[model samples]
Target: MQEINSIYPTDKKECYKLILAQLKSLLEDEPYVIPNLSNTSALLNGALTDINWVGFYLLHNNELLLGPFQGKTACVHIPIGKGVCGTAVQKDAIQLVKDVHEFPGHIACDSASRSEIVIPIHYNGQIVGVLDIDSPFIARFDSVDQEGLSELVNILEIACDWANVR
Candidate 1:
């Protein structure tokens, strides 16, 4: 059985370091897609603080379909260029919004989400999915969070097989 050392350092950077190490252990030699995403979301949900939602939105056709997640029920589909998650894919960049209410076309899958960060996930030279995290407090995410989560997503990008994702 895999056991996560959930007790993380208060220092954000150190916390992420430990989180990444744990993720590597969990994903070692596992190339399957959905299970990896599911475990990743669960791991982040446990490691992160003050975040109410953490999940993935996979690219399908021209839209994003919700995949594995650890939170309340979410919007099943989001079009590219529409919400924060979609905007990340459309721009092919990270969307770190201090206040979701301030975003022009923010999609409120959870009304309580005040801040959000979306990172586009790439695989085999193409965008495959996204990592979407939400917090109830404004400005909950910052550059540190972005950098750390981005690294975590990078690990996901290489660890899972995307060709068979469905």
Candidate 2:
């Protein structure tokens, strides 16, 4: 792969395509999960606009534990089937909330966040964590963002070695 470019396209879908490619290049030779996740969070935090937080919540001891993240201080633990991150793990599906205040049992890690997206990260047929992003603007995340971010998580699932990640 060529050098990862900083020039992001104005088109969302096209930008996502480039972001996926950039992620691949960034993780090309790395296998350890922690550093990979750290860089992934930083990459997304920088690449995506209109977002206040981007991070990972790893499943450990039947709950979600805070992992590498780029944003303000966040809640350290979230139970499964609870908040958006936990619900994503419980449902094993992406959660896209246009208005977090409207979502029952929402966890407000950052009071500035109004919208959020969470995608379950699976490895070897079991969920290991979630990729979460938060936005300060209501409805900041849409289907396009979900699709693109999902692809990013897919790459993370296959690229990192999750053994002993907890």
Candidate 3:
């Protein structure tokens, strides 16, 4: 296989670049739903750099259930307003935690995840799921990531335009 060049010379910027590109490809002609979840999880886990957890928690019936994922075993479910991913959906905003330990009501899905960025997936004016990424280093995420991932969600939102994200 051919090795790919880093989108950014530094690790952080490359992470966003790879994620954005792969998501664009994955959702290209692909509708957002159960069929795409598996590939999305794999693409997230494999394409991104330095991530300990790359997966999704789908919003269904007012609760979050563990969807396709790549990492250690994670929480099976989270209430709409609970934990990092859940709260993101509940609040309909992105949560970029510099340090999960310092954040109030943060759930330690994996002790190794010191930092996290969770973006709410919106559909038809409602939150339906979250794109959650985790890293083992504190302050691994920043505002740039928040903005980049938010754009990612928009792209995905359009791809899955017919599905109910919530």
Candidate 4:
């Protein structure tokens, strides 16, 4: 097992680079989806600062179902086009909200979450799930976050065994 530092780099870009490297090391040769996602969530939660939630919401039966996560209790199901996670799936793009309260149709799983970023996860050319992260501070996520998290999701898209997951 590879070990990671609890301390995260101050630079957002470098932090994501390190986190992505750690993810690659963690997911290598791991064919299982649940465990891989579980570790991935935990890794993000640990590596990131000022984030209250980190997890995956997988698509199933035309709806988003809760998957592995590291945070307080969260909503179990969300319809496509509904909440941040659902919106990412519906639009097939990233939803980086500076203020959740300002977002139309925002779902507050945690009232403490003021900002959020949701990245759609695709596998085999099909939308499979989303990587959702939430922060307590408003405007916590910016363009740098959008790019970094998007790249992180890209790593997950390639690392996981989507055939078994879907």
Candidate 5:
């Protein structure tokens, strides 16, 4: 239960580095999934600016089920290849949307979310879930976010025990 109230570094790379370090410290020796994801969502929600939602959706029985999150209530289930989160798993890549309104199949779980970034989380060479973040500002996410969050997801993939998640 560490308190993180310091301002993030102005430089994006430095900020991500700090975030990664914090994530490592927070997740160390904690191999359980739910609590890990819960803390992870809280960490990102507090660290990132202008984001309205920070959460995870896990793959189960061929669909994505809502997992731990930090935000207003969200969509409970999403089919594969459906929305940004699903599409990330569908394509097995990161989905960085500058504007959710512009995406053809965007799901509006929250109307305030104008942008989103979803990174597919992999385990044992298979997609297990997604690290999903949303912002209220249009074009809030970009390449820097994609890269930084991708690294964060990588940390989670390594630190958590995916086999025990479901």
Candidate 6:
């Protein structure tokens, strides 16, 4: 996997769109893992600003365990209703937190994360994981990001729904 630490002149929305397109191109059959897109964590971390961590925490055993990420070590376990990711799962919705500190029962996976966005990913009609993104700046993910990211993940779930593992 490649590691990207910075963003160039490429447009954020367009870049992410292209990225999603590329990920779609790599799709195979059901329950298949995204081999080339495995490193998306790094790309997202670099492309977006004020973000210290970018990745997912899969739902397993009724808990959210850390998955692939591009940042420092993070908390491995988070129960539903514990943190942003948990809340997203519990509500089956997307959470855009401006300040992690102000969020009740916030899990300090990374002390540097001030803002966060968690989008639930469903597989075979079941909540399987979340597309989590964090930022150091407050209110980093706005409506544009929320809508775009949500739509992007939706496309992923539809095309790659057969298998969104890893």
Q: List the residue pairs that clash in candidate 1.
A: none
lDDT of 6: 0.74
Q: Cα lDDT of all candidates, in order?
A: 0.93, 0.90, 0.78, 0.91, 0.91, 0.74
Candidate 2 or 1, higher TM-score: 1
Candidate that would win on TM-score: 1
Q: Across residues 35-83, which tens digit of lDDT does each residue of candidate 2 receive?
A: 9999999888877888999999999999999999999999999999998
Q: In angstroms, how far off is 14's CA in candidate 6?
A: 3.0
Regions of candidate 2 where Cα sits further than 4 Å from its true position: 1-6
Name the lDDT of candidate 4.
Answer: 0.91
Worst 10 residues of 1 by lDDT: 1-10
Give the per-residue lDDT digits (tens) of candidate 3, residues 8-124.
445656677777887788788877576576777676566656679988788777789888788999998898778888789877878988889988888888999999999887777
* Top-lDDT candidate index: 1
TM-score leaderboard ranking: 1, 5, 4, 2, 3, 6
- Superposed Cα deviation of residue 21, candidate 1 (Å): 0.1
Decreasing lDDT order of the candidates: 1, 5, 4, 2, 3, 6
Residue 74 alpha-carbon offset, candidate 6, angstroms: 0.7
Clash counts per candidate, in order, are 0, 0, 2, 0, 0, 4
For model 1 the TM-score comes to 0.95
By the TM-score metric, which is better: model 5 or model 6? 5
Instruction: Measure candidate 5: CA RMSD.
Output: 2.1
Higher-ranked by lDDT: 2 or 6? 2
For model 4, residues 19-53, the per-residue Cα lDDT tens digits are 88888899898878899889999998888889999
lDDT of 1 by residue, 7-120 (tens): 767789999998899999999999998999999999999888889999999999889999999999999999999999999999999999999999999999899999999999
At residue 20, give the lDDT of candidate 2. 92
| Model 6: worst 10 consecutive residues (lDDT sum) | 28-37
